[model samples]
Each structure stands twice: as structure tokens, then as C-alpha cells.
Target: MPIAFSANLGFLFTEYALPDAVRAASRAGFKAVELHWPYATPAADLRAALNETGLPVLGLNTVRGDLDKGEFGLAALPGRETAARAAIDEAIAYARAIGAQNVHVMAGRAEGETAERTFADNLAYACTAADAHGIGILIEPLNARDVPGYFLTDIAHAARIIDRVGAPNLRIMADCYHMQIVGGDLLTRLTHHLPKIGHIQFAAVPDRTEPDHGEIDFSWLLKALADAGYDRPFGAEYKPCGRTEDGLGWLKAF
Candidate 1:
């Protein structure tokens, strides 16, 4: 069976507005689409695009607090509950507006027991809020190189957090690009953590480019996912080297 692919609009289509990007993904044969921080776009316009194109939003990320100050996220920071919860609330509300299925609650840079507690508490709140709207929460383990000092950097760590929160709707967003950089042995890690994985995303290893030219053998990687029974669409999250459409040979190559 052909793989079901979802374009990560945040990285894939830089040339168009979010709504137009959704339309482009649909025209390019993507089964679904995901997003980064799309708060700037009017939810109505994005929703209208979704309705017109008939594409489901797989997931979206909460805002990265104070980007100018290098704040990647706010969830795991101590003494920032108000800001953190507000971000979560905003993301859930936005996700609802655009009919997104999941919200990736980003855990910014931090450490120690206090940070862990903060993250868990915030996640619990997010999970409860999202559950009411039939949405799930996803936590991803980002690599240290790109997001140094990030609280969530290990899959097992993320799983432990999920277990701690014990929210039925909370799960992990397994990004192969970050995982490959932080931890090799993709198949084993993915299979080991398959039960708790809510979504799987991919790009080339070494460079966050289209998967077709990466050091990672995406053909084998995707096959491994299919063999493991991951029926959900695999998210194509990567930076296009040129115009987004020109870099889409990977879509056809798959």
C-alpha cells in the first residue's frame, strides 16, 4: 500500500500563506498537514482552506514564548505557570478552531526535579483541556544541538512524563530527524516506544532537508514504520532547499 504522507506546512511551503500552503499540500497529494505556530493566521481563513481542500490537520505546536529572547517554549519553566498555561489554553483553542487533532506542548529549556514537576503539571492541565475538545497532546524530544537545554530530549524521558501525568490523551511526537541526531537505532527506538507514539515525523539526518537526499534511508525507515503497523500518516517535516514545490521530488520518490 502507498504510504499516507502529511506535509508539515511550517517547514514545507514557505512561499505561500498558511491557507494557500494547505491548498498546495492537497494539490500535491498530501493526505494531511501539520503546523508549527500558526497563530498569526486567522483561524477562519485556515479553516476555510481546510474545508475547500478536504485535508485534515494532524497537529500543531503551541507558541514559542518570547522568541526574541531565545525562549523556545514555556511549559517546563518554574514560576511561569501563568504564561505556560496561557500558551496551552491558546494552543488548544486554536487547534479547535482549525480542527487540528493534536497540540504539541513544547517543553522549553530547563532541568532538575523542579523542571520535571513543572512540565508534568503543565502537561496535566493541557491534557485535561484538550480532552474536553477531543484533542490529544503530544510531547517531542528535540535534539540538543538545535534546541540546547530543552527539557524534553529523550523518548524514554517523555514516556516517563506521560506515565507521570497519566493522561489518556497525552502521547509522544516521534520526530526521526531529532531522534537520529540524539539517538541512533531508529527502528528499535520507534518499535520500543510505538505504543505511546501519537505521531511520527521525518526529514533527512545531518541536515533538515527533504528526506529523499538524507543520510537516513527513508525507504527503509518508512517501511519499518509500515511494518510496525503505524497506520497514521507519516508527517513530512523538513526544510526545502529551494522552492517548496521543486523540493517535492521526495513525495513522488516515496
Candidate 2:
């Protein structure tokens, strides 16, 4: 089958509320949808929206508290084990409620051995909580340029954490936008890390716009992913230059 596409509701459908975004994505031809955070709207409402539209929610992120306050993620912060686990549990419950297949565990601003240990412990807890439901736990590497002081900014480091946790349900949420910014060897990294990847996302490099207008050619990248046997949906997680629907020519072409 041809590769599927998932709309990133958080970024694309900003004009509408979460439930409306779900319907919009489905109407626009996305096979699935992913959310950055869908907590503001009740889970039942979101689930109803999904059911109404026949669109599956592929994944969602663990709560990233107060971005304006410089708080991004919580999984790796030292001395915050209780809070991290709480956040993870909350995400797992929400994922279960909405039938989401994966949850991206965000690692906050932290460093050194302490951060590593905390991150691993938190992930193990998350994996254990999500395993019974068959939900995958994902860890993503944020680009330092866009998110300064993010604990997990290197894909290799993320792989190490996944190995250390040793949880079958734990995997990487490889966002091509961040990967291209922090580590430019896209194809090689994607090929090498295929075993650990749970989900894939993309946006234009440098500008965070539509995938087709990037320095990185998504057509080539998507073809490469197909060649490498990646059957999962590729997420469109970019800020549109105009109306979200107006900038979907690439999706139409694909």
C-alpha cells in the first residue's frame, strides 16, 4: 500500500478548536491525526470527534507545561521523578481513552548523569504503564537552536536511553524537522535508527513551513522511507504559510 499521511492538528488547525481540527483533517484526506496536546478538550469529546470522522489518532505528546515560562518537558528533570511519572501516567490514560497508538515522552531541560538516570527511570515507568494497553512510548530529540537547553537533543542519545530502558514499547519519535536542524544526515540516520523509530514527523528546515518548500526534499525522503520498508504514516507537522488547506498542494501531489 502507499504510505499514509497524518495531519498534526496542533500545528495545522490552529484556527479551529481541537474537535473541529479532527474533522478538518479527516475532510482534507489525512488517514490519521497526531496531537501535540489535546488535554484542553475533554477526551470523550475528542474521541467522539475521531469516531465521527473515522480518523484515528496516531499519537500525542506528554504535557509540556507552560512554554512561555520556559518549561518545555518533564521526563528528564532531576528531583522531579514523581512529577514526571505523574505526567506519564496522565498521558497513558489519555492515550488509552482516545485509542492513540503512541505517546511522545518529552525530556525537559536537564543535563549530565543525573538527567540521564531520571529520563531512563521515567521512561521505564511510562513503558510499564502503557504496555498493557499496547501503546508505544516515544522519545524525541528537540533541536537546541529552537529549544535551547532541551535535555534530549541528539538522536544517538535518545537511542541510548531507549536501550537503557530496554522496554519493548519504548521507541523514537523522529521529527525530521528537528533532525535536519540538529543532525543533517537524514537518510543515514533514518536508515540506521529504523529499528527504534515508533513514529515520524516532518516540516521544512530553517522555516518550519510546509514540507515541500524545504532545503530537504520530502518527496525524496518519503521515497527513501518507502524503499526502506517504512509503512507507517508520515506526519505533516508544520506551520502553514497561508490557510492550512491552501498549503496542502504537496499532500495533494503525494
Q: Which predicted model would earn the best lDDT?
A: 1
- Residue 40 in candidate 2 has what lDDT? 79
Q: Which stretches of candidate 1 lie over 4 Å from their true place?
A: none
Tens-digit per-residue lDDT, 168-241, candidate 1 = 99999999999999988999999999999999999998889889876799988998889888889999999888
Task: For each candidate in the order shown, give its overall lDDT on alpha carbons.
Answer: 0.93, 0.90
Q: Which stretches of candidate 2 lie over 4 Å from their true place?
A: 66-69
lDDT value for model 1: 0.93
User: What tens-digit string does per-residue lDDT give for candidate 2 at 169-227?
Assistant: 99999999999989799999988999998888999988999888768989889879878
Alpha-carbon RMSD to native, per candidate: 0.8, 1.1
Using Cα atoms with residue i matched to residue i, what is each candidate's TM-score against the true structure?
Answer: 0.98, 0.97
Where does candidate 1 clash, by residue pair?
A: none
